[model samples]
Target: MNSPLPTAWLEIDLSAIQNNYRELCRISGAKVAAVVKANAYGHGLVEVAQAVLEAGGEWLAVARFEEAEQLRKNWIMAPVLVLGYTPPEQVVEAAKENIRLTLFDTQTAIRYSAQTSQRGMTVKVHIKVNTGMNRLGIAPQDAVEFTRWVSGLPGIEVEGVFTHFARADEPAADTTDRQIRIFDEVLASLRSVGIQPKLFHASNSAAVFNYPQAAYDMVRCGIALYGLHPSPETLLPATFRPALTLKTRLTSIRELDAGEGVGYNYRYYTSKKERIGTIAIGYADGFRRVMGNKVLVNGVEVPVVGSVCMDQCMISLDGIQGVQVGDEVVLIGKSGGLQRTVEDVAKEWGTVNYEVVCGMADRLTRRFIHSNDKKG
Candidate 1:
C-alpha cells in the first residue's frame, strides 16, 4: 500500500456504502445491481464493488468493457454487466471473460453471436429497449423484433431485458409512465412470441426510490448506492448515508488588511481586516473553478475568496473565529452541525451530483475508512 499523501484526500466510508446498498434493496424489494461505472462514481470501483457484494447485491454494472475486464483481472468473479457499447472485435474476449454486454442492435448482436459460435460458448446479453431516453438502446417499437432476432441467434443468450427512465426523479410522472407503458408493451410482445429473458430490469437509482414498479428483477443502484439522491428534488428515507468525504488541511493562514486583495485577478477584496485560510486543493483535484466562491469550512458555510488556483484556493475566515492553520477544511462532508453534500456542490457548478463525484481526480489519495473504525 502507498503511504498517505500530505495534501487533500478523500475519505470513503465502506460501511456507509454497504448500508446504502442494503437500504436500496429493502426499499425497492428487488435484487440490487451495484452500478460501479466511472470508478464507482469516484469512490473507488473495486472497493465499492466488494462492499456492494457484501451487502447482498446480486449484480454489478459498468459502462465500459475495460471496466469489466479490469474487474475480472482483479479477481472480481461476480456478474458484471456493461451498460454501454462494446466494440464487436472484443465480443469474443468479453464472452470468454463472462462479462455480460448490453445489446440494442441486430448487427451487433449478430457479431456477438458469430463470435460466441466460433468459440463454442454462449454469450449472455441484456436487451436494452429505448423507452424514452434518446441517448441509447433500440427504440421500443423495434425492441420486440430485436429481442426475437437476438434470442434466435446461434450463440446469443438473452438473459435479461432492460430500459432506462428519462425523468423518474421528477415529481411529474406522465413521461415516465408513458415510457413504462411502452416498455411493458415490448415485454408483452416478446412473451407472446414465447421469448422471455430470465432477468428484466429498468429501474435506475431514481426509479428505485420513486417508481418501485420499474424495479423488475434487479434495481441498478448508482448514485443512490453512494448515498446521494438522483436529484435534489428527490426526498428519500433518511437511512441513506453519504460515504464520501472530501477534506483538505489549511496549509497557511494570514490576516489581510482591509484594502488587500486575494488570489488571482483581485476578484475578492477584504472589506475589513480579515483572516484568510488557504486550503491545499483546487480545480485540478476536481474542485471546480466555478466553486471558487461557494463552499464549506469548519462547520460553517464560507465563501471562497478570489480565483481558484490549480492546486489551492482561499476562503474568507472573517466570521469563523479561532480557526487556525492546519484546520481540516471540508469541501464535501459533514463537520459538526454543518454538512456540505455533493448535491449542494453540484448546484454551485450548475450540474449534478454524478458529475461532481465522477470529476474527482486520482492524484489525491483516497483514504478508505470503515464506519466502525474510531478516529485517532
Candidate 2:
C-alpha cells in the first residue's frame, strides 16, 4: 500500500547538511558538534543527526535531555552534550545513557551527583560559564571557583567548559572579544588550580566564522548545519547549500471580479478582475498567517491575497499563463530561475532566520533527500 502524497511537505537535503558540516569543519579547523536541538531547527531531529555523523561530525548537541534520549532511542551513539538544563530526576538516566549535560548551578550539580551516586554511575558534564549571555551559566568571576567545586563532586566528571556568545552574530560588537578574554582568563585560572576539563568550547555558528580565535577545542555548529547564516553579519561560504525546501500544490483556482473581497475579514480585495489560486498550506502547517504575502508559483512570483487561513491561503495568479490545479507552489526554495531563501522569508516575518526555520510545524511531512539516495 502506498501512502497518500502530502498536500504540503518539506524536502530536506541531507547532502546539503553534510556539505555544510564539511564546510564548517574546513572554516574552523576544529571538531564540530552539530547542534540538533529544536528538532534540528525543525528539519527532523533523528535524520539530521544521522546526516551530521555521516559528514564526520564527532559530537551532537541538543538543548534538552529528551532530545538526547531520542537520539539514543534511535541508536545514535555519538557523543551528545545537553547544552541546556537537565532535570534532577533525569540525571541518573542521563548518566546511564552517557549523555553529557551542561552544569551551571550548584543545586543541579549536587542533585546530579546524589542521583548518579545512588545509581552507581558517573555522569559527564560541561561547565557553562556566563561570559556575556546571562541567560544561563555561572558568572565569569565565579566560573573558576564553580568549576573547581563542581569537579570535586562525586559521580560527576567535568568533561568540558564552554560559554555562549550573545553578540557574535554582530560583527562590529566588541562584546564578543571581551567575552573571549574573560573566558580565557577563567580557563587560565582553572589551569592554575589544576582543574582543566578535557574539552573547552566557546564558539557557536556565528563565532565559528566571525571570531575563529574562540574556537577552543570544538565549535558548536547550529544554524550553519542547516545551511542558514547565523546572522546578516555572519554568512557561510557560497559552497554551503540550504538543506530544506518547503513546497505545496495549488488546489483550486477561481476568477474574482473587480473590488471583490477575499479571505477572512476581507484583508485583501481585488482591484480588478483577477485569477486567484488557493494553496493547500497555511499557518497550521508552520506557514504563519503573516507570511502569505508572497510565494513562488511555477517560478513566477505571486502575491498572496487576503488573510491567510489556518489550512489554506490565496495567491493572485493574475498575469500568470496556463496555470492549473496541482501546480507546484514553492514557499521556500528554488523554482525556475528564482529562489526564495530562508533569509528572505525571515525578512517578510520580521524575525531572524533561526526562528523562521525552527518554527516549522511538526505535522508537515519531511522527505529526506540524499545525493546518493534520491528516492526520498
Candidate 3:
C-alpha cells in the first residue's frame, strides 16, 4: 500500500460490495463477470476486484491490457479480459500474462496469427459482435465468417461472444430490444457454424437490472456492483448498496453578514448572517463544479455558495448550530445521521449515475471504511 495522504478519503463498504455481488448473481441467470475497468470505476481496481472475487465473481474484465497487467502485478489470479482495442504487438505479452483478448476483425486476428499460435498454450479470446451499438466489435453480418476463420487458427480458444447495448437506460424500450434481437441472431449464426464460445454476455448495469432475457452464460456488472443504479428508475433487486463515500474536513469556519458575496464571480450572495464552512475538496478533487447546484452538510441540504474554486468550496450553514473547524463534510456517502448515495449526486447533476461517483478520481486518497468503527 502507498503511504496514506492527508487529503479527504473515499471510504468503500466491502460488505455492501459482497451484498451487491450476491444480488447480481440472484438477478442474473448466468454466472457473473464483474467489469473492473476504469479502476473499478475509480474505487481502485485491485481492491474492488479482490472484493468481487471474494464475493464469488468467476471472471474479471478490464478495458485494456495494462489494467489486467496491473491486477496481475498485485497477484490477482483470475481470468482477466482486455475488452478494448488490443494491438497485435501487445498480444505476446498479454498471452504471457494469461490475459484474454477480444477480437472484432479477421485481419486483426490474422496479424496476430503468430501470437495466436503461441497463445494456445497461454491465452484465449472472445469475439465481440457489433450487433446494434456500432461502437466496436465485428459487424453482425460478418461475425460468423470472422469467427469461423479464427476458430480454426492455432493457439486460440474461442472463449466468448458479446455485444454492448446503447439505449438500455432510456425509458423507451424499443432500442434495447432491437439490440438484443441482433445479438441473439449473431449467437445463432455462431452456433450454425458449430462454434460455441463457452461464455456469452450482454448486460451493462442498465440491462442487467432491466432485461433478464439477455443474460446468457454471464453478465457484466459494472456500476451496479458498486451499488449504483444506471438511473433512479432503473429496476433493481433490493440488496445492493453503494460502496464508495466521499468525505473531507472543514478547514475553517467564517462568519458572514447579509449581502456578502463568496467564491469566484460571487455566484452566491448571503441573504442573512450565517456560518460558512470551507471544505478542502473542490473541482481539483473530483467534485465537479456542476454539482455546486446542491450539496449537503450535517444531513441538511445546503447551497454551495460559490463558483467552486480549484481546491475548495464553501457551504452555507444557515438555520443550523454547532459549527466548528475540522468537522466532517460528506459530499457522497453516509454521514452523521443520513445516507447520501451517488444516486443523489446523479439526480443533482442531471447526468448518468455512473459518472457521478466515477467522478471521484484516483487523485483522492481512498481510505477504506468498514460497517463499524472496530474493523476500521
Candidate 4:
C-alpha cells in the first residue's frame, strides 16, 4: 500500500500476540496486566497494546511516564500504569491523564499527593516492595508503615502492591520462591493493619508460569506476552508462539575463492570455494555487531563473515542450492521445516531474549499479519 517498505523488516502477527496474552491469563489465573514498555519490546507499542486490550488485558503497564503518555495520546482508554519512576514534575500531568504511578517511597507519594490534592483530584498508586531484587522498591520491612502513610496522604489512593523476581527465570533457582515468601509476609503485614491494597501482583512472566501461588490480584507479563518464554530453561505445559519475524531479501550473491576473505579486517576467510550472500540489514537495523556469527538463513545456520556494517552483512551460503539474489532470508523465524527462535538468537548473542527483541530497530518496517489472515 505504501510502495512496499524496506526489504529488511519485521513481521508481527497480532493474532499470535493475542494468543500469548490469553495463554498468560490462563497460566496466571489472575487479572493480566500487559507490560508494554520499550515500545512493546519492539513489536510496535500501539498495536501490541491494542491487541492486549482487545484480548481482555485488565490494564497496560509501561516502564516510563512517557510511554504511558504516548498510549493516552493514541486514545488508548484502558487503565495505564507506569511501572517505573515518574519524575516529580510529571506527576500532575500524568494524573491529569489518569495514568497510575508506582510509588517506591513515601516522600514521592507525599509530593504526588500534594500536587493531586491541589487540583481537587486523586492519583492511583501501586506500592513497590523490594522483596529481594533490590533494584527498585521500598524495603519489605518498611512497606507497612510506608504504605500506611501514603494511603492516608491527601489525594493518594493505594490501589496495588507488587514485587519483582530476580531469579524466577532460572528453573532451579529458589530465589524466586524466597522473593514470594517475602512479598507474602509484606502483604500479610499490610492486611493485618487494614492496609490491604485492592491489587496484589508479584509474578512477572517467569513467576506466572513457575509460581501460580504468587499470582495475587494480577500478573504482569512482558516477554511471555510477546510469545518468547522468559527463559529457555522454563518448563511449561503449553507452548508460546513467537509473534515477530525478521526478514530480508538477499541483495547480492557471489562466489568466493578459497583464499578470499570477507568483511573488514577479514574477520572470516573462506575455508574453501564458497557462495556468499549479502543481506540489507545490520547493526543499524538492530542486528548487533556481535550477532555477526550468530544469525540464520532459512533454517540453515550460516557464518556471518567479516565485520557487520551499518546497513549490510555477509553470510556464507556455501552449500545451499536454488538460491537467488531476491530470495527471502529469515534472520529470526521459521523457514521451511526449521526455525530460529528469539531464544536461539538470544543464546547465541549471550544475551536475554528481551534484548534480542527490543533491540529490533525502528528503521525496520513493521508489517502486521492477523491470525485469521494466516489461515485464509
Cα lDDT of model 3 overall?
Answer: 0.80
**Per-residue lDDT tens digits of candidate 3, residues 1-376?**
5345555778787777778888888888778888899888888898888888987888999999889999999999899888898998888787788899998887788766776575455458888999778789988888888888888877777788889898787756688888888889888978887888898888887787778799898888888888887775685566778788888877888889999998888888888887887888888777888635555577776677777778888888777577577777788866567777677777777777677766776778876655634564
Cα RMSD (Å) per model?
Answer: 2.0, 1.9, 2.4, 1.9
- Looking at model 4, the pairs that clash are none
lDDT per residue, candidate 4, 102-144, as tens digits? 9998678878988889988888899999999989999988999
- The TM-score of predicted model 2 comes to 0.97
Q: Could you tell me how far off, in angstroms, the CA of residue 362 lies in candidate 1 after the best superposition? A: 1.5
Could you give candidate 2's per-residue lDDT for residues 1-376 as a string of tens digits? Answer: 1125878889899999998999899999999999999999999999999988877789999999999999999999999999999999998889889999999999888999999887789999999999988899999888888899988888999999999999999999999999999999999999999987889999999999899999999999899989998888888789888999999999999999999999899998899999999999989887888835689987899888888899899999999998799988999999989999999999889899999889889888898888646545
C-alpha lDDT of all candidate models, in order = 0.87, 0.91, 0.80, 0.86
- By TM-score, is 1 or 3 better? 1
Who wins the TM-score comparison?
2
**Please, what are the lDDT tens digits per residue for candidate 1 over residues 105-182?**
877887888888987988899999899899889988888888888888888888999998889889566898888889
Preferred candidate (TM-score higher): 2 or 3: 2
Candidate 4, TM-score vs. the true structure? 0.94
lDDT for residue 197 in candidate 4, whole number 0-100 = 86
